[model samples]
Target: MERDAVIVAGFGYRRGASASSLHAALALAQAGHAQVTALAAPGDKIALLARVAETLGLPLFAVPLSALGATTTSTQSPASLAARGTGSVAEAAALAAAGAGARLLAVRHISPDRMATCAIAEGPDR
Candidate 1:
C-alpha cells in the first residue's frame, strides 16, 4: 500500500486562512497523496499559526524559525527573531505546547509567501 506525504509551508495567508490548512492537509485527507502547509519565521509565524489554528478551532502551540527551513534567502535577521514575540521558535513551540497541555509536533517553516508553498511541498533537506 502507498502512503501519503506531508508538506509544511512557510507562514502566510496567501491561499487564505480558511483553505490554507485544508490545502496543507490535502494529500492525506482525501487524495491520500501528501499533507502540506506553509511555514514561516518565528516572530510572525507563532501568532500567524495561532490565529490560523484559532480560526480553525485547533490548538496551536509554537512555531519555530529554524524549523522553518534554511533562511539564507530570508531577509529576517537574528535581531528580528528576538524582537518578534517568537524567539527561538523551536524552543517556544515546546513551551507553548507545555502551557497548552498539547503534544508538540516538529514542523518546518517553508519560505517567502508566494511559491514557497511549492518549496515546502518538496519536503525537508531541500
Candidate 2:
C-alpha cells in the first residue's frame, strides 16, 4: 500500500518577531527532514505564521490551543508553560497540527534572536 506523506513544521514566536527569526528556526528544524509539507502555529499567531508560510512558499495551519497541552516534547520551557500551558509551543503545535499518530521528527530549536522557535512533526503513514 502507498502511504501519503505528512510532514509539518510548527513555530512559536513573540510579538514583533521578524521573518528572519522564523526562517532561522525553521532552517534548524528542517535539518532533520528534507522537506516540510506545511506550517502551523497557535491560533493567535496566524499573522506570524502567514508571514512565515509566505516566505517559505508553504501552507499554514492554525493549531488550537486546547490541543497543544496534550503533546509531549523533548524539551520543556517554564516560560512556554506560563504563556501557553504547554512546555514547548513549537513541538506542541507541530504534533497537534499533524493530528493523531504523529511523532516529532525534530526537537524544538530556537532562533539566534530567541524570538522564534520551530519543530517538525510527521504523521502516521496514511
Candidate no. 1 TM-score: 0.30
For candidate 1, the lDDT comes to 0.34
Q: Residues 14-99, candidate 1: write the lDDT tens digits.
A: 32433454235322222332333333224444554555545555433344444333222223336436543333333233323232
lDDT of 2 by residue, 1-126 (tens): 786767989998999889899999999889848599889999988797797798778888898888888888777999999988899999999988888989899989999999999999998643
Q: Count the backbone clashes (under 3 Å) in each candidate.
A: 19, 0
TM-score of each: 0.30, 0.92
- Please list the C-alpha lDDT of all candidates, in the order they appear: 0.34, 0.88
Looking at candidate 2, the ten consecutive residues that score lowest on lDDT are 117-126
After superposition of all CA atoms, the RMSD between model 2 and the true structure is 1.5
